[model samples]
Target chain A: MAALDVAPAARRGRPGYDQNSMLEVIVEVFVDRGYDASSLDTIAKRLGLSKSAVYHHFTSKAEMLEIALERVLGELERVFDDAEALDLPAVERIRRIISEAVLVACARQQYLVLLLRLHGNSDVELNAMARRRELTARLSRIFEAARAEGGARDDIDPALAARLTFGLVNSLVEWYRPDGPDEPAALADTVLAFVRSGMLAADGRGPR
Target chain B: MAALDVAPAARRGRPGYDQNSMLEVIVEVFVDRGYDASSLDTIAKRLGLSKSAVYHHFTSKAEMLEIALERVLGELERVFDDAEALDLPAVERIRRIISEAVLVACARQQYLVLLLRLHGNSDVELNAMARRRELTARLSRIFEAARAEGGARDDIDPALAARLTFGLVNSLVEWYRPDGPDEPAALADTVLAFVRSGMLAADGRGPR
Candidate 1:
């Protein structure tokens, strides 16, 4: 369960998977063991490479961690950029943003775990936290706009709503297994429907 | 901050915070550095006790983790017991349960982080997870009873709704700070009110 050992025949056809691929494997190891406890030598052993070979691409373990985090942040920044460019209705934009979030979490499972566990005490975490806060503020503004447009209920506090919204999205990393049970799209859809319609069906709205 | 430094002066007057107090400090450190990375010697040094002295109460670090998790489980069980004994309506019981959750999260912040971070790989985590699942099932039963009494939306999937309900409750561990701006009761009220009435004022339901 540590690392998948690849055969020599499989390595010949694989071209794109190089330093980045090795780094991703190291990130998974970091997520398993506490980052401070995980060693570069262990990571190198997992990749069937010498420690110097691993260090050839990256200077140190900290550099590997930085590169992995940057990859995740870069993907999220791109998602935010795409969400910002869309001129669709506010609720639709939110739905798309959440869906994209699920996709990212599913695709980059270890990186997402690393991102969530950050305490902001380190320089890397602090920088990532700032970016995350900015992204959250952006989402908060969108929620407010949606409320203003009567796309969502006006009674809900936009800030609180945004927190709950992210909570729902973030919970995916805990229980969502890409290899098990439901497909990612279905899980995302279930979450989207719950968010939009509440837990009640149209007929279940009661006397109101 | 890693762990609190226990001093000689503080020990003389207040009858000294016991092993339980020291365990609380160690829990905070574990939450920060993670379980495997945190050492008993650091906990001992933080509390101004020798490592041998710290080892007297708990045989191993993992036992300390078990007790911390058990303490949280104990609180949840107590809250549920009180909620069950209350002869109020089902909706009122649910409200009380949610409010209790907020209080518990605020009071036991470090323990809550440990509970949330449990990976279910260890026996302690697996046991705690089983208790959690049972608690969720119990809450779902109350939700069913409430719906049967014609208060809740009948078309809702009780399990999914239960997940969302607890999702809102458990999420406080991620961000709610006791030292932060909002009061626990007020924040719980806001969440409960919004959840019950939703964003529409016309729905007209108030917190029970």
Candidate 2:
């Protein structure tokens, strides 16, 4: 997330409270309670902000969703901007994307959790869904290119491969506890290991 | 699911309305609308069952959740009950479980979707959580034994391995459309192929 240096002029209700921090609390409620059931009153109560104060920042629950999704999409889009993306072999770039996704998800846990559960209930959600589909399509092209370059197998349909790959990546939202024993780096390596080599020992190398 | 032959005297309101099929419709609502938002009235309206008729079959939404979970948990448990689960090599058993899980998940799509999203909101959900944990522990033991026998790699922590393995299997709930191109059989083969061999072609052998 960007630094929380909102100019004082943009501040909403209280001098101490910032819009970003209020958004953080709101997203947390959205995560704990499904978005539809979450109300401005509930969000304001959680943050100790008055409902009118919340309105000072975001006009409606839908607006809050729009603002929160913008931040989440921004964080995710940075995956494609990694320096290695342009210079590496397509397969290598794909690996970098997978590895970085785990890190990004860990860093932006709450936002990503909300992103995954989205059902496209509103215009904002539909746009988020389109962005997600676009990202998946981008990965599919990379997978297809990797196959053409003879860097990957073609046994699985490239489209299906893209979907399953995202499935494994997004499943992080389901069970990744920040307090867990495995850190993002180690977990990424393990995921890469399973993706690069079958769970069985490397061919002809005896099991450890 | 229990046998369809409920004693005639035990039949709820309409002779035509049955528990298993009604449970199917109810579970779908739970999947579409998160469980808390799903009402007995909504379920009854879907089935054309009067509210009291729903009560005849289920005392409350919690009871409906309990009954539905029983079928889902039963379907999953039967995987471990497979003769192969006991007789095959531990790693083979693990592989068989992964393969069968996809089939069971596809067979019981609505129920499994509900099962995956379970949040332990009620005693029923808590029981489902316990059953799911038991399944995960069983798989971890299988993974540990499979590693000891040199049928699998030990590089990944066994418990982490169990979680990720289940994540991949359970992810089918997110995207496995019944109308999709791949049958459960084909998708199982694809999953097994990825699990047994990473999407990248073999390390040494020439590409097919």
Candidate 3:
């Protein structure tokens, strides 16, 4: 749920560049320099175009941010929908979801990074956060169901457990580099194992 | 291992403000506005002062960042030292360390937020990361030792366990508010229970 502004009648479709390509370039610049510091002029220059060329496609910086975020949110929401539909056991559904999420993060890494790092500066960001909260609520319900079915531990508070799971997943933005030594599938396994079994010994035989 | 720039030469004596109070103000700004967006002028303005007044206390933004990071790191290192000296059983020590970490997070929340939100933008930030790496390594060793002593699971990877523990603790910055509903002790207990027992049912079930 991102806000998109319509360009002025004079500027709409008057771009020297393709609107879609220009949006892609803007997304790249936003990820590179952060949303606040990245300027339209810098983005235009990087694309070998003029500032007017950039303005023809998007009305302002906020418009670009919303478009980029919309792309990410659409993809993420799709994955969650797929996970929700899987006709498997809860653990299996979760595993499949985790694997798919890793692939999504790797494939759409920049957009996902931007989505995860939103600092809530503007009304658009506030709107995005509300969408995020709604999604979080849905995920939390899934976790609750899984726990109710005895897939997750009843010992841990479901709300806290849900938050911890999401946190572990989100922290991937901080360290999971696509070019790093680990392959995406392998990285997913490592992450999955950590989330499932934790760091302690399986036999509960680790040192104090 | 944060670099401490000496207070500016002109600020050696004057008295109305000094390095510590200035740091307090800086931390507040950092927590309020994401670090990259906060300027020296903003910090000064928040203090009802001028740019010179801010500069008098610190040479640049990096200096403020270093001091803010050091406040948290210094406390972290001390906690590790204290945990190491305790003669308690390994499981108890682990619980104590986790509890202490949550308390540290609650008390020095801003500095801890700064520590947790590093984006790897500079050498200083990278160095801070290196420090975190070393701390994680040390904690991993402790967990490994505890595992060896048969207090934890033998099948779990020590490194992943440590990261999960870290993930749980670090996630506190993202959501936990000191003035929030949960009590610190209660939150710590929830975390400890989850880490020990895990998200699975007592029957060791997988998601469904």
Candidate 4:
């Protein structure tokens, strides 16, 4: 999760923005201008740094993209690993994983957004996408396990259920503002509640 | 919905692709290449037609974008109008709207995908975003009404609930395939059921 912070000492030689801060600006630029359309010059201009200064942190735009993607993908992989190690039931693990993912997404919103927008146009993008597919498949297997344990509903397909559930989580990237009124904890609670029993009142009638 | 089909008779003077078909290829190109990056030449090359042949349907790329957006926006507006006309409770109307949106999205996947990707970079995009915001506000009001009438859980903010619900629907554009095993009817049912009662077994435990 602190992959960017791991090399604060490496910034001693570089003046102005450090590696973490530089990557943050670079990612913002990438998100605003499509990655394919964004060049090193565009990123350098946005950062108000010389091209060499930008190059001081990352060798190429593709490297920046790869590092940014790894930050999010690595965090997500950790979530899955931790969830799998738990002694709890598959249903509980699913809930915990989703709750943790909400926190990760909110904390690393820009990285996650960049990761989500990628369409595998390059080798770095393709690698990120492959990792993403593996994570998705892992979640689907958890859903399958939950259904098998009779904890989750059996009627819906597990793969479809996993997609819808995480899709709801991923949609937060579209509107979630870190400085907004809803704290990550409260937002996570709301998501969990909706995923648990939905928007209808507890006493409301069932689906027709 | 058939905005592109309105001028088919005008195609008699043109050769190769007709207005509707040309616009379809243009949209596909726009989706593949970001709208801002795509030009008339790029669109024509994708369609295997000359630039003037491409121009036979529309005067400019913006015009094509406007027409394409209107197709999805117009269909959505019709859904809202029809839902408002129903003599049901606010909660039921919300259900119908989400259900119908899934169908519209499934039928016009590319247009909806394009609409969802738009970031309001231009006048046409801004107009589409404005219309989209109005639709979201309308849905939020319905959620508010449902809450006031005790049909929906009041704990979650109505606006947040509206965004999350529709966000789930919108995410369908990311992964849904028309020729996939799940039919639109079945998809709609799954979505509605998930929105209504969520993914837990009927007799399952509540949220922690």
Candidate 5:
């Protein structure tokens, strides 16, 4: 599970800037300028507020990152239990997860970009990296189970299959824009269709 | 076609340090510290040379990036024509292209990492981004042909299929160390098998 499964800290926001808006601005700055280049001063100046105003909500830039990533963590960490993912067949489970993943990416694109852009440069980032590894390990087990049950391709290593599946799911963060012409549901459907093409059993068709 | 299709300028290297070795060093640094954090001074210090010495072969960090990306561009641009990729069945063509992509990733790990890490901050990066789009467009065409000929799935849009496939292929930069125990061929095979499953026709067979 993602480390930030619970609600993140720093929910307090000033009058005009609610916690969500502040979080968006913080992540946007981190995205536009590399995480290493963004600073408290930059955030404050962009917000037309004093450093104390920014500090009133979050103690450090690292905290801002944590807040930003928490959104994506919540969305991504719930992939297996999300509404569309509930009660799927083993083969269908793979498709449901990918489809749900695309929707999450579209909804939380900046958070995904920010998380991937980090370089594990600090304690917070190192922890974030470890959390990501944990999520991937959990995913690896699902692929293992699907293959073991004859619901998925057995030729490749489970770990590799997991990475390939997540790669297709996660790469959407790079190009999928919420306001873009493509709708999230259809995107999920298409992505699942393509990835499912590769994950089917050798004899053809889903486990059913 | 890739912008770096032609021989990259400035391959001259000092005695004891061939052009290939220098290129490796430059790309490794770019991969390790990222293009933004890697300064000329840092490269000089890492290479045990003066700033001017680092400058002797390349004028700026941008030039170093260009030179480094060229290696990967060359490998990828040739995937369609590489011995293993040529004269394959429509469905097998997809397999071969994915295989070639994995090998290219293994051989040019640093260069691939550097290319993916770019942020389009400078003209060099903007061009790199454009080149990547062009290559993806070419891959899109291949997917279109395959789907049209009933070699691949036709339900999803060809462009999205190409992106999903390449996303699986290109995300190798985040992992897949060359020194790792997994052989490139096996990795390619596993990836292709997974992808091919969902691409088969309703009756459950490839183009063959």
Candidate 6:
């Protein structure tokens, strides 16, 4: 991977840069430079710290990856768990899950980007992919249940719907700038609006 | 990057593996191993050809990448160009662009995947990204026109809608299998159905 275009001022690691901050930088580097190309040495150099200082927090690059993946995956799984536990209708539960997921994805955009980019090169990546698949499967089941309950359209496949829904949600990481105009809540609202009613006017006079 | 798990039988180059076939293999390796990690040596080995044979078709790895990116980007640009020439309403034109884009994406899944994965690491990648942004901008303008025509809902931002629409469409690269059950036409239909009307039933009695 090409070296990151880091400014010299940004290279100076802030005093008391804790493990969480270090992991954030690590995830950012991993995303910018492909994980395979990124190393602890490069990461330390970016942070303006010695390799030993970086190693004080994490044992290996894979461990850092695991921690990052866990942070995002764990949050998503919790959203799923909480949504599934709700007494609301299946469709309502689906909405809750998607809305919460958009928020989680926005909040943990870098980690989510790394998680999405993984091609299962290592045990950590493979495990993360498995968890992601499980999450999708769980969402598919909810869609199936919603269809059976007549809350969702029956024509579309549940698995396809689940994938496409999350696909749109996940795409936010590619262009969503937290510093940009759209707040996370508003972004989630727009996403929910699109996923719920789509872009057509209520009159339904648009293209077939 | 870890070596691709090529079967022994598949390692041998097929008879008459011309430039088109060679480009296909080159793209496959590039996507699997990543563009930066991939090189002429690795690609030649994967194709069971000598480095000179690989060199006969392309000058360097960058040329191969440029050719692969052009295949997808060129097709998408054609789609946009054709859609713009249509004498239909803005909303209908938007539908045409998206449906054609989905078809292009499915047909050239690998090339499209590489295009989306690019982060401007090189001039070739930056050029492709610029063309992609232009395509998205065109789609966003169509959304704006559609909203003005009262065919699409005006509540959401036009640019955001365009991105989310294509986001769902582009997500096909992650999990779509050509040998899978859903045909490209059927997949496009489902996507169009979702984009036109969302997952909710026509009764609109589902989640808020």
lDDT of all predictions, in order shown?
0.72, 0.76, 0.72, 0.83, 0.71, 0.85
Tens digits of lDDT, candidate 5, A71-120: 78767778765633556555566666667677777777778888776677
Q: Which stretches of candidate 5 lie over 4 Å from their true place?
A: A1-15, A37-57, A80-96, A199-208, B1-15, B80-93, B198-208
Model with the higher lDDT, candidate 3 or 6: 6
Clashing pairs in 1: none
Per-residue lDDT tens digits of candidate 4, residues B68-88? Answer: 999999999999999999898
TM-score of each: 0.77, 0.85, 0.76, 0.89, 0.81, 0.90
- Docking model 3 quality class: acceptable
lDDT tens digits by residue: candidate 3, A108-197 = 777876776677878888778777666666667777788777776666666667677666666665555777755778767766765566
Clash list (residue pairs), candidate 5: A196-B198, A197-B197, A197-B198, A197-B199, A198-B194, A198-B195, A198-B198
Query: Which regions of candidate 4 deviate over 4 angstroms?
Result: A1-14, A37-41, A203-208, B1-15, B36-42, B203-208
Model 6, residue B118: distance off in Å is: 0.9
Question: Which 10 consecutive positions of candidate 3 chain A have the poorest summed lDDT?
Answer: A199-208
Chain A TM-score of prediction number 6: 0.89
* Alpha-carbon shift of residue A95 in model 4 (angstroms): 0.4
Ranking by DockQ: 6, 4, 2, 3, 5, 1
Model 6 in CAPRI terms: which quality?
Answer: acceptable
Pitting candidate 1 against candidate 3, the one with the higher DockQ is 3
Tens-place lDDT per residue, model 2, B80-182, is 7782437677778887888999898888888887777765556778889899989888888888888898777778767777887777777777778899777
Question: What is the C-alpha lDDT profile of model 6 across A100-197, one tens digit per residue?
Answer: 98888788888899898886668898999999999999999999999999877888889999999999899999898878998988888888877787
Model 1 interface root-mean-square deviation: 5.5
Please give, as one word, the docking class of candidate 4: acceptable
Question: Which of 2 and 5 is ahead in lDDT?
Answer: 2
TM-scores of chain A, one for each prediction: 0.85, 0.86, 0.82, 0.89, 0.81, 0.89
- DockQ score for model 4: 0.40
